[model samples]
Target: MALRRITQETFDAAVRENVDEFEMDPDEALREAVEQFQSQGVDLSCIVKAVPAATSDDKHQEQTHEILQALESLSVAQDSPDSTKAAADIKCFTEQCLLGFAQRYLAAQKGAYPVILSYCQKSMGEREATFAALSALSALTDGQPDLLDADGKRFLLDALEQHQDDSSVTRAAISAVRHACLKHEQNRQDLVKAGALPLLTSAVKRHSGCAEVVKEASAALRIMTFDDDVRVTFGHAHEHAKMIVLQHNGLKVLIDSAKAHNDNITVLSELCATLSRLAVRNEFCQDICDLGGLKLMMTLLAGSYESAELVRQVLSAIRAVAGNDDVKDAVVKAGGVQLIVIAMNRHMIISAVCEQGCACLSVLALRKPNNCKVIMEEGGALAAVQAMKSHPGVVNVQKQACMLLRNLVSHQPNYSQPILEMGVEALILQALRAHRDCGDAAKAALRDLGCQVELRELWTGKRGGITN
Candidate 1:
C-alpha cells in the first residue's frame, strides 16, 4: 500500500469533522486523530509541539489575579453615579469570577481562599455581593478549614446569625459553614466554641420553607457531630446529636426535607446517613422511634433496593434504634425484620450492607426475646447464616452473624433446633477457622448450640484457646 502523507491542515480538518459530525469530545477526537496519523506511519513528535501543562499553583495565581481585578473593578463601580447599575454589573461579574475559583478547589488552595473569604466578610451588608462571596467561600473552603483564620470563622458564624431572613444568604452561609467543618476538627470546635449550634438549628426552623437552607443547615449540624467535643457537648454522654437537633426542631426540618425532595437521591442519602449516626446513641433511640424514625427508615429500605449505600444507611439506623425496647418491638411490628432480610439478600455481596444488616438483627435479638421469634419466623436466622457463608472475608459481618445466632439460640431455646437445622454450627466453625478475630464469638455460638464437644476439639491445641 502507498503511504498517505498527512498535513497539519488535514489533521486539523479531520479533528474538526470528528468533533462536529461524530459529536466526540475534543480531547478524545484529538487522540483518535493522532492515532490515525501514527498508524499511517506519520511522524507526530516532530509535528506536535507539547506545551507544558499549567501547574495547580500557576493556575491558582492566574485565577487570583483575575479575581483581584474583578474585586477592584467592583469596588470602583460601587462609587459611580450610576451606582445601582454598576453594582449589579460588578456583582454579576464578581460572582462568575468567584464561581470559577470555587469550582477549581486547587486554585483556592494556593492562598485564594482567604481572599475569597475576605470578600464575604466585607460584602456582608450587600445582599447580592454577600451571596456571591458566601457561595464562593462555601465551595472553596470545603474540607480545608485551615484556609480560614479565626476572623473568617467568626465572620461565617455571624453571617449565619445575621442573615436569618435572607434565604439565599442564609443557605449560602450554612453551606459554607458545613463545608468548612465537614472534615476539619478544629473548625468544628471553633464553631462550637462560638456557639454556632443554636444559630444553625435556628436557621433550620427559621428557613423551613427553603429546602436548600434546611438541607445545608442539617448538613452542617451533621458534620459538626463528627467532633468528639461537639458530640459530647451537643449529644451529652447519654443523648445523641439528634437530641440537640430535636431541641431546635431540626429533626422535623430534616424529615420534611426528605419528604419534599423524595426524588433527590443525594439529599435523601445524606439525610439518612446523618440520621443513622445520630440514632447510634442510646439516649435518642426512643426519641427517634417516637418521631417516627423507624417508619421512615423502613420506607427508605423498601424503596432503596437499587442503592446499596442507602440500604446500608437505613439498616444502620434501624440497628441503632433497635437498641431501645419499644423501638425493637416497633421494628418487628413494622416488618423491619423482613426489610433487614431483604437488604441482606439483595446486597449480600456488599460487606457493609451485610455487616449493618447482621448488626441490626443482633441488636434486636439481644434486646427483645419476642424479636427472636419474629426473626426465625422471617427466616432472619437463615439469612444471617447465609451472610456468614457468603462474606467469610468480612470479619465484622462474621462477628455480627455469630452474635445474632447466639442471641437467637440463647434467648429462645425453642428456636435452637430450627437455627441448628440451618447448619449455623458449621458456618460458625468455618468462621472460627477462617478468622481468628472471630474465634471467640464463633466458639461461644457453637457452645450456645450445645456443641461444647466440637468447641473443645476446635480450641484444643490452638493459641488463644483455638486451633488453626
Candidate 2:
C-alpha cells in the first residue's frame, strides 16, 4: 500500500502524544513516530523529524522559533483587532527569516508554506494582511520553488488580477510569482497560460511610477521569456518572447517604463536587460528602434559612463536591437561605437562590461561596412584587443573580442592591418589554444586578419571516409 501523507502538525502532535501520554523519552517518542509513519509509507523527505518546543511560559524548555510561533499565531481565527497584529507578526517573521540560506526551506518543511498561503487566500479582502501573507509566501518560495504548486499559481494570478489597483499587493503577489516561476519550467508555462503575460505587462504599465512594482514586474516579465526548462527538448522561449512583444505591446510599455526610470540606474539596468531578452524577433528588434530604444539606450549609456552594471546592460540592449540593419546604422550614427569604446576603456577591469562592449561592437559591425569603419575610427578594434589582454583568462570575453575582430575585417579588409597592429593575432592564438570553445571564433578572426591558419577537414573524399 502507498503511504499516505500527513501534515507536520499531525506528525508533531503524534510525537507529542507518545511523549506526554506514554511518558516516553523524547528520543524514543521521535523514533516511534518515524517508524510508525514510514511503516505506513509516509514520505519523510518533507518532514523536519524533530520535537516541537515547549511554550515560552514553561521556562524548562527553550523558546520556540519566532517563525514557528508566527505560523501558529496565524493558524487561529483573527478577529478585527487581531488581523492587523497577525499581519505584523507574519511580515516581521518573513523579513527576519529572509536572510537565512535555509530558514525558509525549513519553514516550508514545517508546514509554513500552506499556513502562509492559506492566510494569503483568506486575507485577500484585507489589503494589509494580504500583502503580509503574500510577502511571506514570496520569501518562502524563493529558494523552495517546488512549494508553489498549481493551487499557489492560481491564487497568485487571481490575487494579481483582483489587486490590480493596489500596487503594494500587486508587487508582493508578483514578487511571489517571479520567485515561483524563476527556475521552474512547468510553473512558468502554467502561470503564463493562466494569464500571467497580460497581468505582468499591465502591471508594468500601471505601476510605471512605482519603482519597486516596476522592478519586480520587469523581473517577472523577463522570467516569462526564459527557456530554462531542460526536460522539454524544444523550448517555447522564442515563442513566449515573441508573444510578450506582439500580443502584449511589451516594447512600448517597457520603453515608456524605462523613460520614467532614467535617473534610477538599477531599474534602468533591469529594464534594459529585459528589452534585450524580448528582442528575439527581427521586427521586434525594429520595433525597439521605432520606440526610440536605441536613443534611450545611448542616452543611458552616455550618462552611465561610471556605472559598470548599467553600461553593460545598455550595451546588451544596443547589441540586441542592432539585429535590424537600420538599427545598426542608427546605433553607429548615434556615436554608439564611441560611447561603447569609452565604456569599455572606463571599466576594463570588469570582464562583463568588456565582454558586452565587444559583443555590442561585433553586432554593430556585422554587415555594415560604414559601421565597421566607424568602429575602427572610434578605437573599437583597439578596445577589443585591450579587453582580450585584460580578460584573457575569461573565455567569453576572449570569444566576443575574437568575434568583434572577425566582423571588423570580414567586409572591410583595409581595416585588417590596423587591427593586426594591435597585436591581436597572438592574443587570438592564445585564446584559441587556451579555451576549447573559442576555437572557431579565434580561428575565423585569424583567417580574416590575413594570417595563415590550419583549417581542418573533417572528412576526405575517400572510401574509408564515405558513409555510403
Candidate 3:
C-alpha cells in the first residue's frame, strides 16, 4: 500500500476492507493507474494526493519529506512517468510544504539551526534531504534577530567537535555558528574557542565536498577568525596554506573551483581573500611567491567578464603576495595593471564585485605610483569618479573607492591631477550631498582635495558644519 498510488474510491474500499487480513494488495489498483498515467506523460498530483498524511506532526513531516524526495527522484529520472508539468508541480508543492514546515518548525524551536542539525542526522540520510533541510533552515534564521538561545548556540560548537567526519553536518553546523557570530560578538569568540576554526579551515582545504557545504564552513571561519585569539587559532590553517602555496596544481584547483561554481563563489572568494590576508604576513608571502600564486592570479584577470567576485578575490590574493617591491615589479611584468583596470571598468557594469575590485585597486595604488597612472588612464579614475557619483546608496563601496582615490591622488599627485582636473572634485561634492553613511567618505575625499567644505555643506550645503 505504501509503495503504490491508488484512486479515491478504490483506495477507500481497500482501506475499509481491512485488506491486509485477506492479504489483499491494498495499492495494487492505484499503482497500476499511477504507472499508466505516468507512461502517458500525465501529471500525478491527483494520484499522489491519494496517499494519506501521517497521523502526527513528526510522521507528517517525514511523509512530507518523502513526498519531496519522490518528486525529485521522478523529476530527474531517465524515464519519468509523467510530463515535465508533473515534475514542476512536484517541485512547487514540495518547496511550499517544506519551506512552510521548516519556517514554522524553526520558529517554534526559536533559532535552533542545530536542532535540525541533529534531527536531520537521524531523519535525513539522502544528500538532497540534508541540503533541503539546511537550505530551508538558513532561510528561517537569516534575519531573525530575536531567535538565539543558549542551548541552541552550544549545539553548533558541539556538533563541530563531534561530527567533523560528515562535511555536510559540519557545514550546516558552522553556518549556524556564523549566524550566531554575526548576532553577537561573544558567540564569535565562542566559535574560535570551541575549535570551530580548525575544523572549518580543514573543510575548506578539502574543496572536494559539496560546494555549498565547504563554502559555508569557510565563510563561518572567515567571520569568526579575525580577532587575536581567533587569529592564533588560524596559525595551523596558515601553516597548511604554506604547504599548498608551493604546490602549483593545488593552488590552481582552488582558483578553478573559485571561478566555476556559483555556490562555491562566496566561500571560495573568502578562502582566496583570507589567503590574501595571510599573504600579508611576511613568511606567508614568501611561500606564495615561491608557489607562483601571483602569476596565476594575474592570469585569472586577463579574460574579462569572468565572475566579478572571483576576479576580485584573485586580485586580493595576488596583493597578498605582491606586498614587496620585487613582487610588485613582477606583477607589473605579468600585466597585473591591465587586468586591474579591466576589473575596474567591469566594476561599473557589475555590482557587489566592485567592493573587492576597488579594494584591489586601492592596494595597488598605494604601492605603485605608475600603476595609479594606468588605473586613471584606463578610465579607472573615471569609473571611480562614476562610482562616487552613482553608488551613494551603498556606503561601503563608496568608502572604499573614495579611499582608493585619496590613496591614488596622494600617490601620484602630479599624475592624478587629470582625475582631479576632470571635475572629480565636483562629483565627490555631489556624492557627499546625501546624509547617509556614504556621505562621510565623500566629505573626507573632498577634504583630501583641499576643499574645506564643512560636513553640513556636503550634506545640506548649509553655511556651517552641524555639531550635535
Candidate 4:
C-alpha cells in the first residue's frame, strides 16, 4: 500500500483538530505533525502558510503559554539528578520555541520575561541552558527593551561577571547587553554604571580567538563609547570618552580583531566607525595616531572595500588625526594625500565622504609647508575643487571645500597660480552666491585670490537686494 501524501489542507485540519477539539498540547502536536510530514517526504512550508492567523489577544495568550511551558520544562530538567544532558535538550527546545514566538509576537513576549529571567538565574551552572536563556533574552530585549526591567538588566550583568571564563555564556550575555543598549542612552549609561564596560573589555581580551564573542563585545563597547555624555561622564576633566576605551586596551583589541578577521566587513566597519568617533575629540587624535591607527587607515583606504561607510569612517579618522601638525605630516609622508584624493574622486557623490576628504586636506594644509605642497602636487586641490563643483548642493561639502581653498591660498601662496589655473576661484564665487552658509569662507578665498573688487560687487548686490 502506498503512503498518502499530506497536503496543506490535511496538515492544517490536523493541527486545528488537535489544538481546538482535543485541546492537545500545541507544541507537542505541532512537533509530531512536522516530524510525521518530514518522514512522509511532504513539504511543510505550505502547511505553515495554511495555518490560520489568530486574533491579537489570542496570539498573545498563545505565545505566553508556549513561553511559560518552555520555562516549566527547563525548570523540571534542571531539577533532575543527571540534568546536564536533559537540561541542554530542554533548553534547546525552549530557545527554538521562544525564537519563533518572539518573532511573531514580540510585544506580547514581555509577560514571559519574568519566567525567562528566573530560568536564567536558575540555570547559571548549566552552561548550555544559561546560554540559551541569554540568547532568548537578547532577542526579546532587542525587539522591546522596555520589557527588560532593572532586575533583568542586573541579571545580565551578573551573568557577564560570572561567565568570564565561559565563552558561550559570555558571548550570549554580550549580545544581550549590545541589544539592550543599542540606541537607548539611559540603558547604556546604566550598563556603564553597573561596570559592564570593563566586563565587556575583559570578554574581548579573554575571547580573543572567539569571533562571535569579540564581535559582540566590541559592538557593546562601541555603543557604550558612542554617547558624548557618556564620554564626558567617564572621561576626566580634559579627557574624552575614548580615554576610557584606551584605558581598557580597547583600541588594541579592535585592531587585532580587524587583522584577524580581515574578511569580515561588518566587524571592520564597526571598529573603524568607533575609532573615528573616538578620534573626533582633539585630545584623542594623537593617541589614535600613536597607536598606529593612521597606518591602518591608509592600508584600508588602499584596499578594495565595497562599503562606503568604512571609507567614510577611515577618511573621518584621518581628518581628525590630521588636525595635529605632526600627524598631518605623517599622513602626507605615508602617501595618505593621494589616497584621500582618490577616495574623494571615487565617492564624490557621497557628501559625508567629500566633506571629510576636504576637511582632511584643509587640516593637512594648515601652516604645514610639506603638507600643503603635497596637497597641491597630488591633485588634492583639484579634487576639492571638483567636489565643490559636483556637490554644490551639499552645504558641508561647499563649506569644507571653501575652507580648504582658503588654507591652500593662505599657507601655500606658491600654489595660488596653479589653483587659479584650475578655475577654483570661479567655483568659490559660485559657492558664495549659492550658499549663505559658505559665503564668509568664499569671500575670504576671493580676497586671498586678489579679487577684492568682485567680492565688493557681490556684497554690494546682496546689500542692494536686502535694502529693496
Worst window of 10 by summed lDDT in candidate 3: 102-111
Best by lDDT: 2
lDDT string for model 2 (275-313, tens) is 999999788899999888888998988888999999988
Instruction: Give the per-residue lDDT of model 1 (tens digit) for 105-153.
Output: 3334345555565566667787877777777667656645567778888
Candidate achieving higher TM-score, 2 or 4: 2
Per-residue alpha-carbon lDDT of candidate 4 for residues 1-468, written as tens digits (9 for 90 to 100)? 554555444776776677788787767667666776778876553234223444245655432234444444555665567756555645554454445533324223334566567767777776777887787677656645556778878988889988789999998898888877765666776777778767987887788778788778777776665553432344321232554555676666677766776666666666677666555556567777777777888888889434677888778878766767778888988999999888888888788889989998998888887778888888888999889888988888988988888888896677778888888877877888788998788888777766653444534434333553
- Each candidate's lDDT (Cα)? 0.72, 0.86, 0.56, 0.72
lDDT of 3 by residue, 1-468 (tens): 233434444433434354434554546544554555567565444333233444356733533223344334433531444445433543343353344433333233332344333433432444444444444344444544235456545555555556666776667666766666654555555555555555665655564556876667546645543443432333344433443344323344444445455344555566577557555356556555666566556655675346787777776676667666667666766777667767766666565566666666676677677777766666666667666566656666677787778777775666545667767776666556643666666666666666666755436555785899
Model 3: clashing residue pairs? Answer: 5-30, 6-30, 38-81
Model 4 lDDT at residue 161:
85
Q: How close to the true structure is residue 66 of candidate 3, measured as C-alpha lDDT?
A: 37
Give lDDT: candidate 4, residue 389: 81
Each candidate structure's count of clashing pairs:
0, 1, 3, 0
Q: Which stretches of candidate 4 lie over 4 Å from their true place?
A: 1-52, 55-116, 143-147, 228-246, 280-283, 305-307, 425-468
- Candidate 3 lands at a TM-score of 0.56
Candidate 4 lDDT score at position 28: 64
Candidates sorted on TM-score, descending: 2, 1, 4, 3
TM agreement with the true structure for every prediction = 0.70, 0.85, 0.56, 0.68
